[model samples]
Target: MRVFDAKLKLQSQLRLMRSENNTIGMVPTMGALHEGHLALVRQALSENDVVVVSIFINPTQFNNPEDLNKYPRSMEQDSKLLSELSEELLIFAPGIREMYPESVESVSYNFDGIEEVMEGKHRPGHFDGVATIVEALLRAVSPDRAYFGEKDYQQLQIVRKLVSQKQLPIEIMGCPIVREPSGLAMSSRNERLPKRLRKEASFIYKTLQAAKVKFGTESAIEVSDWVDNEFNIHPDLELEYFEIADAETLRPIRRKQKENKYRAFIAVYAEGIRLIDNIALN
Candidate 1:
């Protein structure tokens, strides 16, 4: 596999592929390669003539300075993992300055009201940072399709909106949420969890499952309360926010509408390493 840190060189290489009418697929990620990320890459490889995986830990996305400082980086290890998948894969691991030559600041985006709840409500300016980096990468690679995992379902929705609003000629594909055998949603932050807490983290998914079951018979508020109680009793996991919202609009709802799909979104702190997950209620 070839790695390019310079955006100009990467664009030049991709331009040649475009000239040959070779379809390109992109998998944008922060470095800390895991099976979940590889799953996206595998899907891209199956459908596209060429695939580009951009591994730049975007600084603008993190609202908390400490979280940004503590975020993991393992370029050497990440490169090894990608090489195992395919030698033809193009790896774009750009430095911060390369990505943001002028300054490391995010461009503001409206995202309609999609940016007003759940993650958006909690992490201020987070999606703007996400939109900024994603737009930059999408422009740089000029891929026909870009793949994103649905684990960050809100972000996925926002990205769809961003592309729609910007009229970018790219398909934003949302892949399924990959999980461990224990049901814990796969996240780079999972690496920071202590061994004991790692096992305990499975409860986060279990709670979501139970909440889903309850949604069948109970009210949204009732299920929300149950989720809150579950985490309140747990010693290791602390509930941050739980909302059952319309899957498409992402507005928290008290009653499920007959025509609208719904999902249960939960965020929790597993000993200070924040993990978020969601499950479809209908």
Candidate 2:
């Protein structure tokens, strides 16, 4: 895999590939490569002539500075994994200054109503930071398609909005959430989770699964309450919020609509490491 820290050099390489009519795909990530990240890379490899994965930990997205400080970084291991994926995979692991130079002004985006729910509401300016970095990466790579995991369902929707609002010529592909055998949603933050709490983290997804089942027979409020109670069973798992909402707009749904798609979104803290997961509610 060829690794480039400078965005312009990477863009130049991609532009030359474009001259030869090669289609490119990009998977933007914040390092700490796991099965979840490789899942996206695999999909991109299958469909595109070239795949570029950026591993810069975007500082602007984290509202809690401590969270940013603790975010994992394993570039050596990450490179080894990507190298195993394909010798042709381009790894863009740029430094913070490389991504946001001192002279560049901070960029913010209006995501309309999409940013007002879940992650956005809880972490103010989070999505704007997300949009800023994603927009920069999209512009730099200018790939035919970009890949993201559905685990962050709201962020996926907001990115879709960002691409639309900016009129960027790129397809945002949302891949399925990759999980462990115990049903825990795979995440980089999982590394920080104490090994004992790792198994307990599966409770987050298990609760979501149970909530999904109960949604078929209970009211939104009832199911929400049920989720709250389910998490109470595990003192280590702290429930922040759970909402049954319209999948499209992410607006909370008081009543289930046959015509509208819905999803259950939840956020929890397990041993102080925050984890988020979502499931489609039929």
Candidate 3:
């Protein structure tokens, strides 16, 4: 595997691949590589002639400075893991200066209702930061296809919206959420969890599963309340928000619509590390 720290050189190399008629697949990630990340890479490798994995921790996306500061970075370990997966894989690990050459005003995006719920509600200007970096990476790589994990379900939908708004001719593929054997959603932030809390973290998924079951017979509000109560039993698990919302628009649904699809979106704080996860509810 080869690594490039500069955008120009990476794009230039990708250009050579395009000239050779090779199809490119891009997986954009903030490093601290885990099985979940590798899962995206595996999907890209199976479907595209070449796969480009970006490992840039975007500063603009973080609303909390402490969270940004504590976010994991292990370039050496990340590189080794990707190399073991595919000797031909290309890793783009750019420095902040490499990604943002100079300071500039923050970028913003309007996804209509998509950006007004759940994560968007709590983290102000978060998606704009996400959009800024995603758009920048998509523009830089200019790949035929880009892969994102559905673990960040709202972000996935927002990205789809971003692509639509920009009219970028790239397929945004959303892969399934990879989880640990205990059912905790795989996340880079999972690294920060204390050993015991890590096991307790699986409760987040368990609560979502319960919400899914209750959602069928219970009203949206009832199911949401049930999830809140479930979290209340565990003092360490602070319930941020739980909503039964339209899977597409992410607008919280007070009453279930027969035709519209729905999902249970959840966020929680365990010892100051925020983790988000979602599950489909029929």
RMSD of each: 0.8, 1.2, 1.0
In angstroms, give how far residue 201 of model 3 lies from its true place: 1.3
lDDT of 1 by residue, 7-108 (tens): 999999988988999999999999898999999999999999999999999999999999999999899999999999999999999999999999999999
**lDDT per residue as tens, model 3, 79-139:** 9999999999998888888767787335878898788778989999899899988998999
List, residue by residue over 1-282, the lDDT tens digit for candidate 2.
Answer: 899999989989988998999999999999999999999999999999999999988888989999989988899999999999999999898888887887433477777787878888899889888999999999989999999999999999999999998999999999999998889999998888888899988988888888888888999999998888887887798988998899999999898878999999999998788999999998
Best by lDDT: 1
| Number of the candidate with higher TM-score, 1 or 2 | 1
Q: Which runs of model 1 end up more than 4 angstroms from their true locations?
A: none
Error of 1 at 262 (Å): 0.6
Candidate 3: what lDDT?
Answer: 0.91
Judging by lDDT, tell me the better candidate of 1 and 3. 1
The 0-to-1 C-alpha lDDT of every candidate, in the order given, reads 0.93, 0.91, 0.91
- C-alpha displacement of 243 in model 2, angstroms? 0.9
Clashes counted in candidate 2 amount to 0
> Residue 266 CA error for candidate 3 (Å)?
0.6
Q: Which candidate order results from sorting by TM-score in descending order?
A: 1, 3, 2
